[model samples]
Target: DETALGTLHSNRSAAYFAIADYANAIQDADECIRLRPKWAKGYFRKAAALVQQQRLKEGVTAYERGLVFEPTNAAMKAARDDTILLQKVKYVPYPTSVMAPAKE
Candidate 1:
């Protein structure tokens, strides 16, 4: 099934993460990690997928693992903090009209 896996697959997984398909993205990230365990981005991507899935606890754990290898990654730290805060706040979606988009 190696051929079933490709950069396109990884890219699609990232796209899924962008669109909030967390579970499916995690599946792709799973294969990516299996194929490239030493690759830091793979774990980082998985952490993002986990966060999107609302697996915040495990996502923070994953972020910690990634930090062990990518200590200088600022984005990772910000995301980790964001994940942790999700547990602290009880957010309710507000109406878009209340906060309109910024002017271009």
Candidate 2:
């Protein structure tokens, strides 16, 4: 029954994420994790919601935690890699050419 409840919460979290409701998604994902600590799906949901909210560090941490339980999950690996890329891009400065005004 607890696993079933966890699944329900996980489903709700995904639905919230689909609607761009990162807050609710994260909340439900947390509930799922609480209900099923070893389940990777909950971590995936939480990571995704955190990423959507621009909480990159936390997202990456969540992904790492999930990977500890499901190291063979290709999807989670890809998502984690993408999030790392996003973090890099976020901190990269624009090229001078892009920031400069064009020739008159």
> lDDT values of the candidates?
0.78, 0.98
Per-residue accuracy of model 2 over 1-104 as CA lDDT, tens digit each: 99999999999999999999999999999999999999999999999999999999999999999999999999999999999999999999999999999999
Cand. 1 TM to true fold: 0.70
Off by over 4 Å in 2: none
lDDT (Cα, tens digit) per residue for candidate 1, span 10-43: 6777988888888888888777767766555667
Q: After superposition, how far is residue 13 of candidate 2 from its true place, in Å?
A: 0.5
Pairs with backbone N, CA or C atoms under 3 Å apart (clashes), candidate 1: none
Provide the TM-score for each candidate, comma-separated. 0.70, 0.92
State which candidate has the highest lDDT.
Answer: 2
